[model samples]
Target: MNNSKVFGSTLIIAGTTIGAGMLALPLASAGIGFTTSLIIMITLWALMAYTALLMIEVHQHADNSATLHTLAKQFLGKKGKWLASFAMMFLFYALCAAYIAGGGAQFAERIANFTGVEISGTNATLLFTLLVAGIVIIGTATVDKVNRVLFTIKVLMMAVVLTFLAPNVTESYLMSMPIEQGLVIAAIPVIFTSFGFHGSIPAIVNYLDGHTPSLRKAIVIGSAIPLIIYVFWQLVTLGVVNQATLIENQGLSALISTLATTVHQSNLGQTIGIFADLALLTSFLGVSLGLFEFLGDTMKQRGVSSSRLAVGLVTFLPPMGFALFYPQGFITALGYAAIALVVLAIFLPIMMVRKARAQSQLSHYQVAGGNLALAVTSGVGVLIVGAQLLITAGFLPALG
Candidate 1:
């Protein structure tokens, strides 16, 4: 129960949760109104929190530290293992692509603003990838230290943006917009993606040496930090930028560009640009680290060489290729990634917990609400999946 360990683990969870997905929040919820968006945010936060706790419970039941792949195989057999691995890989790859595309755009914009020289998105992606890949290749210990610093800078930048925009945010902006029904459903996936901390649960469990109370506290506190940050962010962005403007602009870059023009402040725009790049960078480190470690471990278990370079290639190349080809699909990538996340984070946890219960193997830390909670959580997961499918099929209109 070392306090520092708890704090470090908490930072890991918070850092992972607050990433590129956040850049899509204001746009996604724009049509839904700020008040309804707030309610939706709180609801998704509680749902994700519960699912994350379930993941920890499953992890603690293991004799030693095991990943989602291992847990799925042990509890749900080969089919489960295959599905879990595919979902995890797809989700991570999609997220990596989204971050790469986002980081490159933000980085390129910052460069152009400062120097008046334009860099192509593909070139920016390659440059940013190579830079962060070096730090990621060094290993998780280095990543943890870097993440701490980056996380602090990210929070401060967010504060600065909010502070500048605070005066412009009126009660009218917060309360005036009408909630659009279909748009709210569309925003749920984005909200889920924003609060996505479950992927880091196993890493945190190992980090804290399986101390349940400390791990639980870290999850709760870490998740709550983003919840607070998001609320204020929505307030500022929705307050300053109108709903129609968000819908028209329709992506992270456009949103920020609009903010700058609307606010008539160059410094504010620069601060937010820097903030976007830092946010994506920190998340890239956490996610790439997770993917690298998972692949390296799986390779070792299969009696293969898990060298740094080998794992780095496997971890980054596909996402890099995708980002290169589809450099403008940041928010779309996150939305699709949410489908895979629901499978891995939400649906998988409920199934795992139920199987563990059936086997009479319980952990010291169990998520309460029992079968009813599982039913509700699973239903919510299914509904999210449905929304994603309908959106993908063009049955429901896509939100920003």
Candidate 2:
């Protein structure tokens, strides 16, 4: 029974981490070579784990019923509540957009490969948007079960890919020099997005029933798994492919496709292509289901009959519309969305940590470093993220 619970929680953590951003990490790392990117990966991982712990700890101050709203209100007052709410909404929608767009791309590429009849990226976007929405509307209790199966498939396939890809990677890729704007504000959004550390706040807190210590432990352990995966993935990609190919293809999937074709044959390449499509499809579905569940819970807390369809639309529309109207805009929006999540994950949580301390005595797990240093670190993270949003939005240039 204990093992089952642990496995379930681990799957939740892994599924959350492997969302839309996994599709983008290869693209983000391509511009800056692998070695420098790996350092940033570890730094962001630490920051994410810290903030996640803080967020979960804050929930302990109140009951499990306390939402991000209550937590923000208690910690940072009205302004903080408003900002955190808006950022959370924006972050989820923006993330959904990335999932919608990437899933469509994956679906289109697979169909074209299999049937030799191309579905344009645009049509695939609409088709998947509607299909995933339908799945959410049906209210399947088995979604969690489906996720376990899908997560298994995803991990096995990734392991296979890494096994073949890792041995071919060399030291040259790991020591690549840092370019200008290597860790600048512009890069902040993508880095945060790739981490997928946002939705974990409520997820972990609720799972632990607002027990501060357990929540903290879960967040730390939960986040560590993804951080390791991201680092391993970056290393594998850098080692296996040349810098030029990674840059030109713009993502790891492209590299995977090329590598499969070169190492095996077109048939083997097509199999991996299908596997990639399946992985993205299931990842998006898992996220949509989780968000929909959150919305349902929110409504239930208010004594309202939650319409699954409405919740599904809430999950689907912002992203689907973005996918349909502004397919090309998804990547740019993703960077901004990542920065937005950093606000939701880091800033609000840090504020909550202070509030929790002020409200009561600190638990053993909640006591981290000195309060002053934590404050400074959280503040710097927020500023860096905000600056990245500005840069991504074209208000500032990448450092030269």
Candidate 3:
């Protein structure tokens, strides 16, 4: 049991899960209210943790160096691999678009404040993506070292912002009831995506050399860190800001301004601005690294010989195009990511494990509860996708 390896893996999971999604949580959950949001987050954490363990179970039967692309190809055949590929593209692209839309606007605003230069949204997205894309193309080590620094700053600012905001919370606000039952359904997509670190599970397994004990400890502790931070963040954000204000401040910039007014701490806005800017960059780097790896792997598997810049283009372009057209898609993009994640994170693992059980030699490690538990997990995935469809069709109301 190498403690350092497990600890590093834990931070990867925590860092990946705790980024831009934090920016959207208070607004998305506002319609459903704090208590309901808290319950949903806990339930989803259990589901995500369980699925991550299922991935470990699958890893037991496969080579640890196997990425998701290799595993899907070996276990489920071409159609299955293609499905995994599609879902990964959808999820990663949506997330990149989200970070760009959210972060680019922040960048543009900050620039205008400091230098009186107003960058347009598309230019901002392009510039912001260019800045981070190089670090990603340089590869994982650079991204990891940079993300560690950003993640640490985010944690410290998160603590300070929570401290300032905590004293102003009204108990009644914390207990506010859902404005509409349907909004609870809508909030599921965003909240579900918030727990996404399944993208980095293979990386974790490889880091620990497929040591089951270390993998289990890393996944549990890594994921739990984000859940704890989210609890405190939700406590402060939802408790201090009323439902009407949450509704009014639909955009992140507006929300920060609202907090400044509501909390009356002059520095509160500055703290939140720094925290959010760091959050967006760290999350972008994390998700982009995942995309970079996934895309690079796919290209190699297909014998597509390409340079790092080529891979970077494929990884960053579609999202930049999306952000270009619909510049304020932060929340909407997350919803889309959640839908694709239902397939990538939840359904794919269920299929792999079931197939592994059938064809491979029985491994010592298996997720508790047999086929019934797998079925239940798949069922929950269905519900999340369905909820998103309802929102898309205007059958359910989602907060901005």
Best by lDDT: 3
Ranking by TM-score: 3, 1, 2
- For candidate 3, lDDT tens digit of each residue in 320-373? 888888887888899989989998789999999989899876447887989998
Q: Candidate 1: which stretches are off by over 4 Å?
A: 141-145, 176-180, 303-307, 361-365
Q: Any idea how many clashes model 1 has?
A: 0
Compute each candidate's TM-score over C-alphas: 0.92, 0.86, 0.95
lDDT of 2 by residue, 1-400 (tens): 2445555665567667765566566666666777667777788788777777676667767767777777788778899877876787677677677767667777777778668988888888888788777776776666666666776777777777777667777788666654556434455568667776556566556665566655555666777888888788777766666666666675435655766754543355665565566666776776677567767776787898757777776778778888777665545667767667767777777777876787786553565776875877677676767777577566755321
Q: Once all C-alphas are superposed, what RMSD does model 1 give against the true structure?
A: 2.3
Cα TM-score of candidate 1: 0.92
Clashing pairs in 2: 169-239, 185-388
Better model by lDDT: candidate 1 vs candidate 3: 3
For model 1, residues 16-118, the per-residue Cα lDDT tens digits are 7888778888878878889988998999899998988888888766854787788999899999999998898888888888899888778788778889999
Give the clashing pairs for model 1. none
Local lDDT at 175 for model 1:
76
Worst 10 residues of 2 by lDDT: 178-187
Task: Give the total clashing residue pairs for model 3.
Answer: 0
- The order of the candidates by lDDT, greatest first, is 3, 1, 2
